[model samples]
Target chain A: MKKLIIASTSTVHNSGYLEYILPRLTSFFEGVKTILFIPYARPGGISYDAYTAIASKGFETIGIQVSGIHEYNDAQEAIANAEGIFTGGGNTFELVNQLYKNNILESLSKAVLTGTLYLGTSAGSNICGVTMMNTNDMPIVYPPSFTTLGFIPFNINAHYLDPDPTSKHMGETRETRIKEYHVFNNTPVLGLREGSWLEVMGDTITLKGNLSARLFQPGKEAKELDSESVINL
Target chain B: MKKLIIASTSTVHNSGYLEYILPRLTSFFEGVKTILFIPYARPGGISYDAYTAIASKGFETIGIQVSGIHEYNDAQEAIANAEGIFTGGGNTFELVNQLYKNNILESLSKAVLTGTLYLGTSAGSNICGVTMMNTNDMPIVYPPSFTTLGFIPFNINAHYLDPDPTSKHMGETRETRIKEYHVFNNTPVLGLREGSWLEVMGDTITLKGNLSARLFQPGKEAKELDSESVINL
Candidate 1:
């Protein structure tokens, strides 16, 4: 059975890193002593070591030691041996790029699917979907493919923001972008708002956290899913 | 001499489509009776014909007829004979995907390089840069390559927005995203805000329109370049 917590973000307003979700993580990752951290998505282009240190601090409070995959001699071995795996948020493009480059996508996916406990935030959560197409990150680097772990049947628009009616910005709204996505792709997309996450256990997927997630299916009206609802689409 | 108007967006707040810069377009596209419209970006997944109709209406005010490239049997020939070319914004990935699929990138680049009058808004303007790595649009589709026309020396972050201090959202800001891009690429990126544009006349590229554009070069501070300033870097 696959078990995962795909969060929309690692931090919320006025909170320390991973402060908002640590309580749930403690229970979700129970019995796991150490986690293999994939830090390739280095946010703002930080070094892998530095990014891993941040991840370590977040997991330290939960009594789980965090080890960056890069610290290992072989990344595939790291994933296979990790009691728990965590991919932190950063640049999805670079994360996907590095995953392809390192040839670890398969190992990482297999380990997680076989029931290795997993936690992903932002860019990390984006990869848990069918493709990385819904990522809001800039195309800082081109990955080999948009295909991802497909842990969830649908794609996830992490950190999804609703249209700000008061703003004068002319950019496409989050909904408009996802609708445009449906024109080329048939895959469903879930707009996961900040602090929201999808908890996957065995064959079931449930929306966790306080906010509602907006679900977008091809040629269908976007529906808002309240927290704790099962995401069938 | 190459002539192009690469704008951040076609429609600004409280303005009709292309109404923001029609006067300058009239001068830039002078003597052109008809313009080829590349509507592949198809904002909001609108059909090519539907998207073209929108472009036609915008260009009609300037006394120019708009013909979508899809209307022509031979897209290469259409580009070869076009008096003016306009690529409107939507989704950059799809736009580049179609351009490659149609094998029109070379022809389109050749036309623009040989002094064919050109206007690009949003997704269209994005291709005028070195790569589509800086676009804010969703990946929605996998483009053959991030490589673009390279009409200019650097990339353009169209519809660039400033950071909102009041917001609680944790998504990467436009500036942070571009900085991340710089880590992977040495190319300079101009954060072209809404209503701002870059005008290229032969070797001279000038910033046009109402506001200042932010420029991000690798390993340097982001500087604000006022409208009407020459863009040498």
Candidate 2:
């Protein structure tokens, strides 16, 4: 069984992505022979190419075009045979849709439990929650329920941050947005800021990033933690 | 019955409060009778004497020293007879908790329906959600299940914006934060930026502010609108 490495995206267009994850890739897939890429998130869009290009940086990448229960065979084969699985980010809603449409979330979960070396970033990081209800993106599209891959016990608020003073778009501040998530959820939410990554190696969840990560527990003050802290799942 | 106005706070400071609301006060209360100010939000803290100071602006402002349900008599009476109601900005979680503890959210909702001129800034603005589940600030304290005044059918994501390039805080971007909201919610959430006010008069909801307000409907593209455009909610 391989380990699961979930990450928040730093940047895909620049050297940041490689700089952030290269060391982790070396530590996790040190002796692995091959890598399989699941780029279903981009689905008929331009990001497919973008992510495929990004994933190709570390290993031999293959884009999985699977998208429904009928596509389960292909998904299973990809997960079962790949030395490591890399899931890229895009739109969480779109990712959930494709995963559900193909009935692959469950398959992927099972694979992770069996040690498939599961790797996810951004939107991919969101699906690892008990329910992917706490993502930090828009639902430009929907699949079924916002429920994600469910590899992790708590909800992940990916790409979290405080607002920029110069931004012109009007919307809820990040803090207010997460608080609202507590209304429907009893599970804690991990507000993972940009440049942060959670390394899930053999049942251990370690926080890796600068600044304090905010944790929301119902009826409690938001807890902040530095990157070196280890959060027990 | 009085008219109701809820403004999404862009920034929360002593001056920000006065600049954003002074216009609404002059325009709405123009020829009206006395204004009853509810300063129940401050609790025991007398930092700025915000209540008396706001009252000194020439309105008959009375501080509601009530904290729990036992001291909620004036809340009912004030809502019933006031020419107009203005709920100033402070901590929304505190305001919501007080309202719930006092059993006044429902009453305030009724007052709005009956046509009380209602003006809620910051924390006050947050309580207008159907469930009060919508708010953009940190959940400093937990309140009863995300329920609010319900003046607005959907949730309010106040002070929405992108991430600050210079700030050190780590969290998800505002766009991703709201996208997560869409996963569990079917109702649209209005990302009302600071300095933005949603004027609700006799069921007419208009988006007014210097910036464009973004509206997110689950499974649809986010829509942006500028000031003076009416929202049919």
Give the number of the best model, judged by TM-score.
1
Angstrom error of the Cα, residue A167, model 1: value is: 1.5
Q: Give a tens-digit lDDT track for model 1, residues A1-233.
A: 99999999999988999999999999988898988999999999999999999999998998999989999999999999989999999999999999999999899889988999989999999999999999999998889999999999999999999999998999989999999889888999999999999999987999999999999999899999999999786
**Per-candidate TM-score against the hidden true structure:** 0.99, 0.58
**Candidate 1 local accuracy as lDDT?**
0.93
The Cα error of candidate 1 at residue A225, in Å, is 1.1
> How high is the lDDT of residue B82 in model 1?
97
RMSD of each: 0.9, 7.5
Candidate 1 C-alpha lDDT tens digits along B109-172: 8998899999999999999999999999899889889999999999999999999988788998
Two-chain DockQ for each candidate model: 0.91, 0.11
lDDT of 2 at B188: 77
The per-model lDDT (C-alpha) reads: 0.93, 0.64
